[model samples]
Target: MKDVQTCLNAMTVDVEDFFHVSAFDKIIKPQDWDQYQPRVDGNTRRLLDIFSRHGVKSTFFVLGWVAERYPELIKEIHAQGHEIASHGYAHRRATEQDRQTFLADVRRSKNHLEDLLGEAVIGYRAPSFSIGYSNEWAFEVLAELGFSYSSSTYPVKHDLYGTPDWPRFAYQRAEQIMEIPIPTLKMMGRQIPIGGGGYFRLYPYALTHYLVNKYLDKEKQPYSFYFHPWEIDADQPRLNNASAKSRFRHYVNLQHTESKLDRLLQDFRWSTMKDVYGVNV
Candidate 1:
């Protein structure tokens, strides 16, 4: 709540259906997305309405596959004056493949999304925070793909993704790509998750709420917060029967999310990440 009201300056929205999550790796294939239920359309539209009400603009990191299939959504996001970005052609994480594979994914996805939106896509984020330590070199691929900025690194350590060694606040020119690592606040001598993804969902909103303003008071850096539309839709069916830990991570705070979001809107002066970081290029 405090982050949105007292500290938040930018938001990043990943446009993907629920099933595209890596936790469903075994059962889901790209071709199987058609069978995906309810689609993200309704949920995302609600999200847009909320942002609209807040007069907030965010960068929508859309999947090329999703954008290709749902150009209207991409168009709508752009029509509303937010930036359109690539979240890869399919939803595969960059860590799922080697450099060659990751390059291909970035190249193809960029081409596809730019074609659909009829504008150059300037930013990219991996499916999950897929460009952690080992694959930090993937920045070269993104720059080569004609991207000028990226938001794929998470400045924390985690089983699925994060790069603790990476800069916590937004920094740029590493790999010649302006990198906007996801929002995190320093805690107990280490970085903590407070921006988006499972961390936002799993933790108590009060805790996240306090941490954001606490960091802002101490550090003076604008905070970044993110959430998916699927998260706001507490009833969005569990996309897969994920592991106990993953399930807890993904679904822990679904019930309290909407109220928490309402609280955030009331509290924060939120906007998109690029404006916060000054990455207008």
Candidate 2:
């Protein structure tokens, strides 16, 4: 295991509520999203407080819908010295939209975020890490619109999204866009997810801890960890009528998230993508 003390990992947050998760799309239509109670503001504030207490700054991939609803919240995130990146307008996956539609969404989100902060937003994270081999065009669009980098690929096999064959670390694409894939560890001839999200919650904390350090020692690369604001909000409203799998993935171990996060934050140095990678964004 590597000494985990000095490595500054890329800490990121997908700033969306439970209702905005892709797993609940079949049950909770986007049109009905407004009718549901909005819990993102409070949940995100709690995260900000935790980061402040730990003296850690992170990148917040803000959904355009959330930014539109809570403009001041976005301003506050920026004011607090956190990096703000686009998470697209609506939570739609790239594969779900055509090239024209995808470009529009990217432009709309980037423009909105840049307009709010009066500074260029150079980073983006696709909703649900939806950019894979089939949707490679998305990166070209991101570069064309002035985004310097994207953390929109999860290099693992999954039903929802994955580019299992993509480079598992940060690399520049043909379009001049830097791609920072979610962290994964190679073991037993396969890549296992050690990054964050449901995997972090589902696995024992000890295993996740070991895997993170192992990756650090072997690859000498800082991990890019991500989680949603809703992950730590244990008391947030639960979605009704959702499938058993979605409920299990979303609700399991919610109560344990904050404590585990505290340990991880203390164990690893954390910072925004731009700072850790020294990208001029």
Candidate 3:
């Protein structure tokens, strides 16, 4: 086994509620998001408590909408010594927005987080890993807004968002901001995603453990994992109107996520994105 204390990886939380997910965007409009019960505060606090127990510090890529409504929650997260980053305003995908709109969205979120934390918020992860080849200009916008790095691209093939040709590891973009693609393992000439999110919940704990170990041993790089605040909240309201695929992806194994995360935390050392990648925020 790899020495847990020596292999520091990045743990990130996309601080959005169940309604904010892109999977439900077609069914649940952003303007109607207020109608949903505010469960993010409780769910996120639960995650914070879990991290506290395990002595882990993670980066929270918070939505501007959530931060606005739960400013105290944002303060509490920062007070706990977790890194505060942006998940853009309204959870709009970068691919869905024009360059100008994308810039405005990210800037709005970053400014809100910085205002709450009283520090620079430099890291960004696009909604749904939405920054792909067509919207590569998004990187220039991120750079122009003074973001130090972005974990906005998934270099694996996926139905919603991915650029299989993008670098599978952290690489500096020509636009000047560091682009940290979500971690994947190349096997049988394919990039298998082992980073986290629905994939983490879908796979059994033992399989995930083996795959993560394989990635670490073969790649010899930090494994960055991400999941949403609602992943652990099995009791959260379900959008029955969403597509069958979306519902399955969002709701599958909800009860097991927290336990799996606890194991993941104990299995490896974790830190903020800035710390793991040596990026200044």
Candidate 4:
């Protein structure tokens, strides 16, 4: 039996280019996304190579726009033994879409992904972690569309998106699908966000290690951590006109991400979400 210390945590990548980030939504339009230099293909291939070096398999929540533009990339990700899941079409937030629009977006993405892989896409994640109290009904659409799980809720409070009052770990929602709120812990009566993304990039490696170990040893729960390919591309073009806060969040520690990820992969057991959660993909 595997030791609890080495139990697998879910490692995920939100596969979108540097320019597709939600931070620049006001300054950039989806129609103009193509105008930006595309770096996702090369950046994601770098992630696949890194995971390969460590013998780690990951779940890739691919944007439909990226998949349509690079079907071969999706094929190669699957061929390399990584799980392919939808990151929604258009990268629109759930709160920004009504039920019908959200449903159509997810269905379109899933259908295109399944067609490309010849297999069911069982997992999903909302862009910008936008499935919150206002859009709780989004769960019904996810379940109806045959997604078995979603990692869309971040329980920590954020200006853009969060359901801080929601369960901090994975829980079945609407009795149809599992809603895995990004892993967090209560400290000093405040929810501390530890489940990767900007938090992973912002926090020191020792603190991240301590936090993950606390979950493993005390809570006995494997954490779910996510990152985007753009996080590691330190040399990627910068959006100079973005707001100061958005610029910092998007660009902070870009040079340190890959090294931190290397340490993370080596220090813990990681696997695809389906395998870690026991959901067949």
Candidate lDDT scores, in order, read 0.77, 0.91, 0.91, 0.91
Q: What is the lDDT of residue 163 in candidate 1?
A: 83
lDDT of 4 by residue, 18-55 (tens): 87888989898999998888999999999999999999
Candidate 3 lDDT over residue span 236-273, tens digit each:
98788889999999999999999999999998889999
TM-score of candidate 2 versus the correct structure, residues matched by position = 0.98
Prediction 2 global C-alpha lDDT: 0.91
Ranking by TM-score: 2, 3, 4, 1
How well does candidate 1 score on lDDT at residue 228? 71
Candidate 3 regions off by >4 Å? 1-5
Residues 1-281 of candidate 1 have per-residue lDDT tens digits of 23434455677788887778776666678788788774688877887888788787888888777777777887888889887888887788888789898888778878887777687888888888788767767888888887888888887878778888868766776577888878777778978788866777777878767876787777787776666767777777774556776667667778787777776666767766666677655
Candidate 1 — which residues are off by over 4 angstroms? 1-8
- Poorly placed runs, candidate 2 (over 4 Å): none
**Candidate 4 at 23: error in angstroms?**
0.9
Candidate 1, pairs of clashing residues = 4-268, 5-267, 5-268, 10-271, 10-272, 10-273
As a whole number from 0 to 100, the lDDT of residue 25 in candidate 2 is 89
Question: For each predicted model, how many residue pairs clash, with residues at least 3 apart or on different chains?
Answer: 6, 0, 0, 0
lDDT for residue 115 in candidate 1, whole number 0-100: 77
